[model samples]
Target: MFEPIIPLVLFAIVATTTPGIATTLSTASGAQFGFRRSVPLLVGSAAGLATVTGAAAAGLAGLLLAVPSLQLAMKVIGSLYLVWLAIKIGRSGPPNLDVTMARPNSFLGGAGIQWMNPKGWAMGLGAAASFAALASGPMQLALLLGATFGLAAAASLSLWCVAGMLLARLLKTEWQWRALNIVLGLVLAASIVPMWRSA
Candidate 1:
């Protein structure tokens, strides 16, 4: 049991810490709104990821994976959404840390991103396939996987948020802010590579 659990723990860490839509948004939110205002988004994203994990453990992921048309549709929709998000991020100006001019994302916004994120779906499917066997019962495995992914997502997102906050101090000028936004946006856009390949 212990040995099997170790792999799941490692998988959770890697999945949560990897540079994806959720982490990217969390960092951006922190930079735009600061840590205090970003808490809701982080919590919402964690909860969303947990739900994804549970769905995967319950075999929804497997069904989705088996259907190529659904996968293609998801890829197309997710990619389009990501492109829109990238455009928004790129156009955004440097945040006024003293007085936040740009509004932070809401809890619903955060959750919605996870629901539409192809990367999140992939992570859920991978985790369920790899770790579901570690538990004695189906319900136990789903709960365990969900909790592990949720906690890991929260912790990892918090760290990214802090990193973004630290980076905010360096972006003092308009050009610096624009450059950072463009870079972050591009990085986010690049994350759709897997979806492209799968499609």
Candidate 2:
């Protein structure tokens, strides 16, 4: 039971720590809103990822893998959704966290984002396929996978969020803030590669 724990932890950390859609949003939220205010985004993302990871480990990934049309549809919808999000981020004002600014994303918005995230689905699928011992016999693989991925992803996203917040401090003017935001938006849009490339 404990044999696969070490390898699984390593895999989860490496997989979740990589920069992707979730990290990008976390960064944006942290920059636009303070770290404390962004807690809902982090928590919601973790919960959604955990649910998906657990379900994938329980064999949901294989079902999706077998359906080419479904996969393509999901990819398309997810990509478009992200593009829209990128546009919103790019068009927003500076990271001043002004009271007049529109509200940051809520917990439901954060959770919804993960639901259509192809990259997250791919991560779950990869975890399911890589760890044989995950389903060896204890009937607890889903629980284990969910817990591990959620924690690892949360930690990784928090780091990115902090980085964004720090970057905000370097922007001395409105133009500088706008430029930084546009760059972040572009980076976020570029991150949709996983949605198309995921196997």
Candidate 3:
């Protein structure tokens, strides 16, 4: 039971830090809305990822994995959502709307992006399955899986968001912001690669 802890922690760190749905969304949100304004989105993302991770650990994702049609359906839905996010980000004009201390829709958009991210699914599900196979008790395994994953995810996402904000601030120009959006669009587009690999 305890032996799996090391691997579990490693898995959590790697999965959370990897350039996937959460990372891309956080970075993009940071660029678009700034770090201070992306907190809700960050919280929502963490909540969603934690839910998915918990589900995976509890064998729910395995159930999803069992039904080939269902899995395919989820994949399709997730894929379409990501593509849509990229399109929306690409289409968004300059920041002429309104700038305030308030967090913007980009945060929710980030959470939504993670909700539909296939890589996120893979990470959460894989960690749960692999860790569960090693634990003797269900509750203990679930706690371990959730704690490690949740902490790692939160920290990693904060890094992404901060980096995005810093980059956006550094550029400090309308054109730079637009270019940032394009770069974010490219990142979102690249996120589909892992899904394709899994398929």
Q: Pick the candidate with the highest TM-score.
A: 1
- lDDT by residue (tens digit), candidate 3, 121-154: 6666555444444455555555666677778788
TM-score winner, 1 or 3: 1
- Name the 10 consecutive residues with the lowest summed lDDT in model 1: 190-199
TM-score of every candidate: 0.63, 0.61, 0.56
Give me the displacement of residue 108 in model 3, in angstroms.
5.7
Superposed model 3: Cα runs more than 4 Å off: 1-4, 60-103, 106-111, 167-199
State the lDDT of candidate 1 residue by residue for 9-68, as single tens digits.
655665576556787788887877779899988988998888887777667434444553
**Clash statistics: count for each candidate:** 0, 0, 0
- lDDT of all predictions, in order shown? 0.69, 0.66, 0.62
Tens digits of per-residue lDDT for model 2 on 1-199? 5654665675566555544567778888777787888888888888888878887766743454455355455556645665775677677655433223266677777777777897677667655554533454323667778999889878877886786778656766888767756776776566555334333
Ranking by lDDT: 1, 2, 3
Ranking by TM-score: 1, 2, 3
